[model samples]
Target: MINSKFVKQKEVSISVPPGIDDGQMVRLSGMGEALEGGVPGDLYVKIHVRKHPYFRKEGFNLVTEMEVKLSEALLGADKVVATLDGEITLKVPSGTKHGMILRVKNKGVPLGGNRRGDIYIRISVQIPEKLSKEAKKLIEELKKEGL
Candidate 1:
């Protein structure tokens, strides 16, 4: 009831009255956040609900893992774009080893209700403390093709 505006306002989302703290965002009076020309709307209650310390969600899915280094896992890494839902792309497989586990279906974590959660990238192959001479002759010719 910002002052009753005739009639033609229907946009609400209000939901942050539980002590507010997630990140904080609850400033509403008449919910005015439409803005287009007749401008007159504002209703957003995103009380800091974007938690991603290290990525860990099970509902609406979201997991985290990616440490490929050994030359991008034997030079085979291009579809590894996902800083936590950059759309969805995970296909790290050149020599991708060391616990390899890449899955980015759905992109995980929406929980709005429709349901959508999936993002797991656990690959770790990086062991080059100090090997330069052409990467130690390509790791001794890939250990004589033994890889």
Candidate 2:
């Protein structure tokens, strides 16, 4: 429902299409002002999408960042990630580097019918700020092995 000075206050049905971006306009024909013996003007409504705390949209694709420990990046691990549908487990291959993007197919924005976009997860390798003596020794040993 909307209130307009040029038209009577009434309820208007607006169907938002899938994958519509912010600032896009939806025109409502014959819903504006009408003059004597003249056609009524159209009403234009602009869309504004609120930002998500965990994901950002790009086209139909959704992007998010995931932090992995240094050991996890070096070794393979299965991590649980939150998705629009629900939570899913993602596999991080061994030797996965920082800034590597992993794609989960058909997990993004709806594309009408039965199609959907993809979700991109960017890996962020977290290095420990403070290392224990034993951990430092193990890293030193790895360095000696040309790791």
Candidate 3:
């Protein structure tokens, strides 16, 4: 419901179709008031989509970032990632580098005709922000071993 000076307090119904991009306009025929004997004006609604906290749209594809532990980056692990549909397990390959993109097929926005774009997950390895004494010792040992 929207309030305007032109139309005191009236409820308007708008039907938005799928595949409508942000800033696209949807026309509502005969919704605006006519001038004297003239025909009613058409109402154009500009669409604005809010940003998702865990997902971003790139064209038709959906992009998101997943944070993996340092150990998981070094020794592969099956981690749960959030998608538009829901949570799913993604296999993290060993020796995976930061910012590497993993593609999940057909998980993006619909592009009409049953076809959809892919979902890309960018890997972000999370290093320990604080290291304990034992953790520091292990790192020193690995450093001494030329790791």
On lDDT, the candidate that comes out on top is: 2
Cα lDDT for residue 5, model 1? 46
Question: What order do candidates take by TM-score, descending?
Answer: 2, 3, 1
Model 1, stretches more than 4 Å misplaced? 1-46, 56-65, 68-94, 97-101, 110-114, 120-127, 131-138, 143-147
Residue 74 accuracy (lDDT) in model 3: 85
lDDT of each: 0.66, 0.94, 0.87
How would you encode candidate 2's per-residue C-alpha lDDT over 1-147 as one tens digit per residue? 896455478888998898889999988888877787899899888999889899999999999999999999999799999988999999999999999999999999999999999999999999999999999999999999999
Question: Which candidate would rank higher by TM-score, 1 or 3?
Answer: 3
Sliding window of 10 residues with minimal summed lDDT for model 3: 1-10
- Per-residue lDDT tens digits for candidate 3, residues 32-130, read 778779998988889998888988999889999989998899899998887777888889999999999999988788888888888899999998989
Check candidate 2 and list the clashing pairs: none
Query: How does each model score on TM-score?
Result: 0.33, 0.86, 0.78
- The count of residue-pair clashes in candidate 1 stands at 11
> Count of backbone clashes for each model?
11, 0, 0
Error of 3 at 103 (Å): 1.1
Candidate 1 C-alpha lDDT tens digits along 18-49? 22346667777546645456655655465666
lDDT-better candidate, 2 vs 3: 2
The deviation in Å at residue 10 for candidate 2 is 2.5
